[model samples]
Target chain A: MAKVLLKGNEAVVRAAIEAGCKYFFGYPITPQNEIPEYFSKELPKIGGAFVQGESEVASINMLYGAAAAGARAMTSSSSPGIALMQEGIGYISKAELPAVIVNMMRGGPGLGGIQPSQSDYHMCVKGGANGDYHNIVLAPGNVQELVDMVQEAFDIADQYGMLVIVLADGLIGQMMEPVELRKPKARPIEPKTWALTGPNGGKPHRIYNLKLQAPDLEQDNIDLFKKYEVIEKNETRYEDYMMDDAEFAFASYGTASRVVRTAVDKLRAEGYKIGLIRPQTLWPFPYEAFKRPNIKKYLDVELSMGQMIDDVAIACGDKNMIEFFGHTGGVLITVDEVCDFAKKIMGGAK
Target chain B: MSRIDRIFCAGFGGQGVMSMGQLLAYAAMLEELEVTWCPSYGPEMRGGEANCSVTISDERIGSPLINNDATVGVFMNGAAYNKFKNKVQPGGKIFMNSDLIEDSNPRTDVTYYKIPVNSIATRLGKIQLANMVMLGALNDQAHLVNQDMLLEAFKKVFGAAKEKYIPINKEALAEGAKAAAEMFK
Candidate 1:
């Protein structure tokens, strides 16, 4: 396969095309504008549909419309834009429509700076639109994974009938990397037999997230939880680097994980035994993957801070070995600083 | 196993920092090395300074970011130099465009090559290709990848351009390599 130098946003667009995504609906926003620009140019060449919606709300709802018609549909936006799309995303989740939404996160509370940030962890995992719906979130550290996960997000969404999110930041969205396009899968397009796709010689199918009856709503919630349980059991993914017989473990994800990996390598070279646990599946949390008997003795949770650390705390549980280190509000933590912390911990442990 | 070498090229926006990094990355892929070229984006790439990190590895690269010190720093302007000079490793090489930067001295510990890259590109009739020229010089001096590999990268990158521009770029590359070779001696 020929390697092409592509920005992360462009890579995602290319990957979506390769994955047989037929429709893209998005509005322009900083840090993720390349995605729509790419689709606008390339989608037509591939005979796909690209639409620039009036707003992020409209774009996500349009995606919901496409997904209801059983097309592989996607949309991308930054933090504020994503906030606007939350209502539609909730509807998609509750309606169980398989769609991919990419949040190339920028710093936020509102119209925050366009720098890369991991501040949207809670909003992505917990704040879909309303009440108890869960969206499977995949965090990619670099460009290749950005492409790979978009494909994976589609597959997972199709398999489980859920909204799949590729949670990335402006940094990952903007960075360029050589990516080999995966061969197109020849799977038949599976239409949702239960969706409201114009009734064909039968009773019309109605699609809505609102269940008026209390008992029915409770049962629906229970069924959703059961599906989430299956995902938690089977789909948690995390990578352990230099973890064998290590006294300290660094936990992080996305762009921060790259920094941790570098720190781990440098510390290993310096004879300081520090391992790294990078959670690939943010929603499933990879709790089981990190719970090995040996690994439990030495795990230090690191994050962009105050956000993902909550997951680490949950995973670590009564096993109080987990500690925290972080740099918040878009402050990047250097490898040297991480290495120093690792050395201090290793020295004390020994 | 495939080996990937990740290189970061940084400097001012118009200095062709991103293009230079991209050329090498595309060239490395042509040589059958797994490659990735990522540019700094957002407001940074607009009118301000720019930089790109290109990873050409034989294996699948785990990350595209350059967290540690860069193996090479090509600073085409004062902002580039001030921003990235300290980011070069102890024994790493720094290529500063002496034509634009009058005082091109970095720390005494590392090897610094002062090339009048802009002047050379001006002589070649197109000052925009200074980034390509610096790339040629770097390949000549460091020999980190290979001359043939870089030329192959140039071909792969510029294949879509008009047929006539290919030879001009190749010549520009050769001129860059010659200039760099002269400085090393």
Candidate 2:
């Protein structure tokens, strides 16, 4: 396959088209505006639909409507916009709707600066609307993964009957890279037996998260928890680099993970045996990978900040082996800082 | 495997610094080496300075960050030179656009090559392609990558519709290369 130069935003839209997705609803936001712009031009060419909704809230609701109608639908927004759509996302999760949402996160607590940031780590994994629900979040580091994960996101959303998120950041969204567009596979146009496709033959099918009856609502929550358990058991993914002979490891995800990978390589070349543990799936968190007896003996934790360290501590048993370093509000932690931390840990200087 | 060569290119936003780094990385990939090209942008990309990093190696690259001692530094503007001059490795080469950079000051330990990239681009009838000219010069001086590989990278980037620009770009590349070779001699 020949490579084509594409920005990260454009790559996601192209991947959506290749994943058999026919509907996209989104509003413009910094660092991710290119996504909606690309979809506006390309979706119509393929007989697909792209709508710039009135707001992120309306956009996510449109996704909900399309997914309920058994169409492959998606929406994208940045940190602030995503926060606005949280209520709608809660509805989609409660209703078990199959849809993909993209969060090209920018730095934020409120109206934060427009720079790439992993500040949304907690929001994406732990803050999906309101109740007891989890959205399968896929974090992509580069444009290639951005393209590949979009397709994978759709499949995961449909198969699990839940909302899926492709998490990226301003850096990944604005960057350009060479990508080969994959040929889309033909999928079944018919909705699943459980989907609310208007009473296929006999009884009318209704889809909604609101079950006023206590017994029915309890059963629904139980069923959703069970599905999450299965996902936890089966779907965690992580990449390990140079860990076999290392005495310490740095853990990071998304764009920060890529930076950690470079730092690890440089440290290795300088004769420091440092390793990197990068999680591709943020929710299930790949706890088992770090829990391995060998890795436990050699692992320390690192994050954009103290956010993901909680997961690391949980995974590594809170043994004080985990160390945290970060600069908040979109400030990038340099490779030198990470190397110094690894050196101190290895040299027993701390 | 030996360490991957990581290069950082920095300049104003419209200088095509990102494109230049990407072309080099892509060319290395065509040579069957592993490569990664990551551009820095955001609010920092609008009218502010922009930069990118390219890592090319015999094995898979773990990350794409360029540390203080990077293998190569290409500065297309005075601001880039001022910001990154101290970061180049002792023996590493610093490529600067002589047309825009009036001051040739750099660390005494590192070798600096000043190429008139903007002037060459003006001569070529397209001033925006100055970045390409600088890339051509760097490719010749470093020989870290092959000319054919660079051309293949350009083909991948520009595609067929813009095929006509190939000859002009190649000419620009060749002119820059020849000028750099002469300066070193």
Candidate 3:
């Protein structure tokens, strides 16, 4: 396929379509409005549903309904909008429905701003609404990876009968880059035997999450965590770069990782043994990457006020070897800043 | 050795700053060079000094940010010029609208070309073509892409606009390129 220029938001829309996603539910939000806008135009042509609900809350529940009926459904929003959808997301997880939710995150504790931000790390990887379930979180750095991850998100969602979240900041949502149309190799999905398609020999097939007894719900939680354990073992993806003999290691994801790569290159070019451990899957967190042999120090890079540092701290488990560098309220951490910080940290200075 | 041209384009909201930077990025993509175009997509873009940063590199781009490392600055208005004039790296180049701004205190370290884009576009019959004229002027001075290749990129980038506007756009590009050659010499 010929490489064509595409904004990241639009590319995710196209990729989801190519992956056989036939339904989209979203509200218009900055930096991510292109996803719904492009899908609204493209999906109807392909005989799919494009519905803009009254708000983000309604939009997410629309996804829940669509996914419950055995349709591949998706919804995208920025930080605050995603926060509104968290209750529905928690419901979807409890119902064991398969859907793809996209968070092209912007700054926020509340309505922060319409710029790129990764401040939703804890909300995404931890609990936002309230639950013990985990969403398969895929953090893609570039437009091409975002394209690929959108396709993979659908597959993973269907495969697990669970929601998969495509995590990108506003930079990936808004930037333009050349991408060739490609779909990941399709995984054989188990038939949705649990879809709400009416009676099976006059017996109602339930897609309900109304476990009344505490023990039953506790058992359900236990079963879900067991599945998550299998996922943690199987789906944990990370990119280990130049870590052969790395003395200084940097851990970042999505946008921050891209900057860290340049900083790593600059440091390596200057005779420093620096490497990067980029967690492509934020939920699975890839704690194994932190268990390296020769890394003396770790730099936790983020677009928030040190949210990912906690994860890095837990991952580096043994030593208090991690230092944090981050920017918040929609400010981006640049390559030069990362370079300077790595040097400062490596110099044994805070 | 390959040179990376990190270009910054800034202007008012309706001045086609994003469009100009995107076209160059598309041109580089067409040439199979690695490129990225990132716009300042916020409230400020709603008429308050809109801008976009572009990077066309021979190697994979790690950070698509020109932040403070822009090698070229193209400003279409005085506000845009003032905001980004100091962002150009030392020994870098700048192209500004001569009709709107006169950088009386221009930097001594880099070359500055005052391109009369609005006047050229006015002469070319459409004032909106100033962005294209500026694009051509930058291409003329930077030699970033060949004229024919840039024309191809224009047709590809604005697929539907080609039939109705390419000829005039071609003229605007040529006039700006010619103007640049005359001025720089």
Q: Name model 3 segments beyond 4 Å from true.
A: A200-202, A348-350, B44-46
Top model by lDDT, which number? Answer: 3
Worst 10 residues of 1 chain A by lDDT: A295-304
lDDT of 1 by residue, A1-350 (tens): 76677788889998998888989999999899989998999888878889999999899999999998888889999989999999998999899889999999877768877778887889997765788988999998877788888987888888889899999988788876677787634333355697767889999888877889999999999999999999888678888888788766788888878777877777777777678888888888887655656653444433355577667767766547666666655556677776776666666543
Q: Can you rank all candidates by DockQ, best first?
A: 3, 1, 2
Residue ranges of candidate 1 with Cα displaced over 4 Å: A183-191, A296-303, A348-350, B1-8, B34-36, B44-47, B55-68, B104-106
Best by DockQ: 3
The TM-score of predicted model 2 comes to 0.91
Write model 2 residue lDDT over B56-170, tens digit each, in one string.
7887555566768678889999988888877678889899999888764557887888899999999999998798889999988887699877888888877888888888999
- Across B68-182, the per-residue lDDT of candidate 1 in tens digits comes to 5667778888777777777777787888888877654549877888888889889989988788788888877766567666666666666756446766677777888898778
lDDT of 3 by residue, B1-185 (tens): 57689999998988889989988999889999999989888765466778899999888888888877789999999988888888899999999999999777888988988889999999888999999899988998898877777778877888875658888888988888888889956
Q: Is candidate 1 or candidate 3 better by lDDT?
A: 3
Candidate closest to the true structure, highest TM-score: 3
> What TM-score does each of the candidates earn?
0.92, 0.91, 0.97
